[model samples]
Target: MKWTEVQEIAIQLSERHPETDPAKVNFVDLMKWTMALPEFDDDPKHCGERVLEAIQQAWIDEVA
Candidate 1:
């Protein structure tokens, strides 16, 4: 998933880390984990704070 696929990425993250709280995740770890997803394939340079924030919010929504 690309950085632009915020919801998809959040779904994957929620499934992969069910025990974790998306609201508590910092951007650094968030980016690292996103990059670690098997379906993820994109340039790290393409990601930014806004992308991470969207992903985190989506993940929180997914969990909620």
Candidate 2:
């Protein structure tokens, strides 16, 4: 998934790391985990703080 697919990525992340808390994740780790997803295919350069923040928020919402 691309960086634009924020919600999908968040869902995947939440599932991949059920024990982890999105709110406690730093952008560096968040970006790394996002890139590690098997379905993720976007360029690393395409991701930014805004996109990471959106993914983090979505992940938090997914768990909540």
Error of 1 at 38 (Å): 0.2
Candidate 2 lDDT by residue in tens digits, 1-64:
8999999999999999999989999999999999999999989999999999999999999999
What is the overall TM-score of model 1 with all chains considered together?
0.98
Give me the overall lDDT of model 2: 0.96
The candidate maximizing lDDT is: 1
Error of 1 at 49 (Å): 0.3
Clashing residue pairs for model 2: none
Every candidate's lDDT: 0.97, 0.96
Clashing pairs in 1: none
Alpha-carbon deviation at 3 in model 2, angstroms:
0.3
Q: What global local distance difference test value does model 1 have? A: 0.97
